[model samples]
Target: MDQRVSSLAPPTIYVVDDDDGVRRALAFALDLDGFEVETFESGEALLLRDGLDAAGCLVLDERLPGISGLDTLRQLRARQVALPAIFVTSHPKPLMRDAAARAGAPIVEKPLEAETLIAAIHDLLRGPTR
Candidate 1:
């Protein structure tokens, strides 16, 4: 086994999106980019799993059915789960952006370019300053 690979646990990406196509497409893309992925249809599904303790980042759609992505992040924070998160949405209003910022999540607009999302994920994994 490669020493580097053995030294670090594989990074898993938790993706929460209401759109079936979008969730599947993102999982496919991220998998191809060499990241492990877990998909949820809604923020509620993710919260129910109680599996956020894993070493990974979160890619969430802002306007989820049950709990909004920002609210989900807030809940996670309240629980002391500090995973890096990125929010994607078609509507990028100032209020949403501010909320996401407060949660320490970057908001990416929908109709996302695959490369950009991938790059952002990589950057987040690298750490906040990177």
Candidate 2:
């Protein structure tokens, strides 16, 4: 019933962050690099999305306002959706990094580098090990 669901595509990337500027920047950069990108204002917005295509990676902010990014990642995994996610965070704590690694996701720092971000996206696009 959702319009977004009707046009989902594999190899797509979703950027979820509370900051409008960050979301826009990431989306623009990825779009220029030939990736279909969708921006969400919050983790909840992303959670409500439908028709997830395989090979898609979620780029979520670790400090989302309402729903913490770690919790969101846990919920997704619990639902059997093994999406490869790259967390963007301003504060990089050891516990956060460990948790992200445990979730099989990578953490990219706040001021993201273009090449590194691209590489992370590429790795996610590669999908999980068989």
Candidate 3:
């Protein structure tokens, strides 16, 4: 069998942040950590893309250009795409926390500790059984 044909792809981390600097930094960090990373400038872009059903998780920014992170997650859930998500925000409010919790996504406040974000991603990928 051809190695390319049989080889499995690495798990992907879908990152959606409007800020270029933040998005790039996250992609770099997650890439270095041995996971494939895909980035989008806004939640809308992520929703427009296909292949979200792939094995992986999402790292979304709460304040997006068009749709908020919570709304994005709600849309994904409506479509039956229950990929584990970690929401990052610089200014988190109680309402946002409540919404995130309702969507089954954990919200992590910024400036993000690399270890914490990485650990969250790992834990999410591991599934709830862990």
- Per-residue CA lDDT of model 1 for 20-55, tens digit only, reads 999899999999998889999988888887767457
Ranked candidates, highest lDDT first: 3, 1, 2
Candidate 2 lDDT, 34-129, residue by residue in tens: 888999998888889887666788888899899988888887777787778989897789999899998888888968776788898897777766
- What TM-score would candidate 2 get against the native? 0.86
| Per-residue lDDT value at 41 in model 3 | 94
- The 10-residue segment of model 2 with minimum total lDDT is 5-14
Best-first order by TM-score: 1, 3, 2
Q: What digit string (tens of lDDT, one per residue) describes model 3 on residues 7-125? A: 87878999999999998999998998988999999989999988784598999999999998888888988889979999999878888888888877888889988778999999888
Instruction: Return the top candidate by TM-score.
Output: 1
Candidate 2, number of clashes: 0
lDDT of each: 0.86, 0.84, 0.88
User: Candidate 3 at 71: error in angstroms?
Assistant: 0.9
Clashing pairs in 2: none
